[model samples]
Target: KKMIHAGAGVVDYDYRGEVGVVLFNHGTEDFEVAAGDRVAQLVLEQISMAPCVEVEALEDTARGAGGFGSTGVEATPAKRARAEAAAGGAAMGAASAAERTPHVAGEERAAAAGGAEVA
Candidate 1:
C-alpha cells in the first residue's frame, strides 16, 4: 500500500499487494511514532470478485453558466469608487456579502443600485 498525507488526519491510499495502516495527527500539536509502534493491526482475508458495468450522464444547474472569476476582478479606480459610493449610500455595514447578494440574485436591483442597465 502506498500512503500519502494530504493534511493532518487525512491520508490517501493506493493499495496494491499488502495492506498497511496510516496513523495521522488530527490535532494542531505535533506527535511522533516509533518504528514497530502499533499504528494498526490487520488480518489477511480472501475475497471473490465479479465483472460489472456502469453508466453515467452529465448534470446541469442554474449556476453552471458561471465559472471562476466570472465576475470582474481587479476593479478600475472609477469602478471601485462607484461601488464604494453605492455601498456607503445603501449602508451595507462593511459587509461585502450584503452588497453582492443582489448582484448575484437580482440583476435588476443590482443594476438600478449601480446606475447601470441590467443585461
Candidate 2:
C-alpha cells in the first residue's frame, strides 16, 4: 500500500520501485479515510525540449521590449484632469438619498457642467 500525506508531499518521476502513501491530518479534528475513497490522482505527460540558439541582435517594433502590464498602456492625463475638475466642482452638502431622488443620478454633475443635464 502507498502512503501519501494530505499536505506537503512529493513523488518524483524517477522512482521505479513500489510506492506507498502516508495519510496525514493537518486539521483541527480527527481525519479518516474509508474504503472506496478517491484520495489521490495521477497524471502522465510528455516534456518537450528545444535547443537554444544565439543571435546578434533582436528585432525591434512599436512598443518594443515592453512586458508586465506596460504594453498598450496610456497615461490619459487630459481625461484624468477633466474628471478631476468635474468631481472637484460638485456640492458637498450632507443630503439624504430620499431627499436627492429628484436630482437623479447624474443630475448634480450635469447641472454643474453648465449644459449637460439629462431629464
lDDT winner: 2
Q: Relative to the unseen true structure, what is the Cα RMSD of model 1?
A: 11.9
TM-score of model 1 (CA atoms) = 0.25
Per-candidate TM vs. native?
Answer: 0.25, 0.30
Clash-forming residue pairs, model 1:
none
True lDDT of residue 8, candidate 2? 36
Score candidate 2 by TM-score against the native. Answer: 0.30
List CA RMSD, all candidates.
11.9, 13.6
Q: Which ten-residue region of model 1 has the weakest summed lDDT?
A: 1-10
Q: Candidate 2's residue-wise lDDT over 1-119, tens digit each?
A: 24345443555667788865566755556667788887766556665577889999989875688877765354233343355457773233223221333334555534433334434
Candidate 1, residues 1-119, lDDT tens digits: the string is: 22423233322244556545556565666666689765564544565466766759546775567898865475643355367686675343323433554344444334334544333
- Give the range of the ten consecutive residues with the poorest summed lDDT in model 2: 89-98
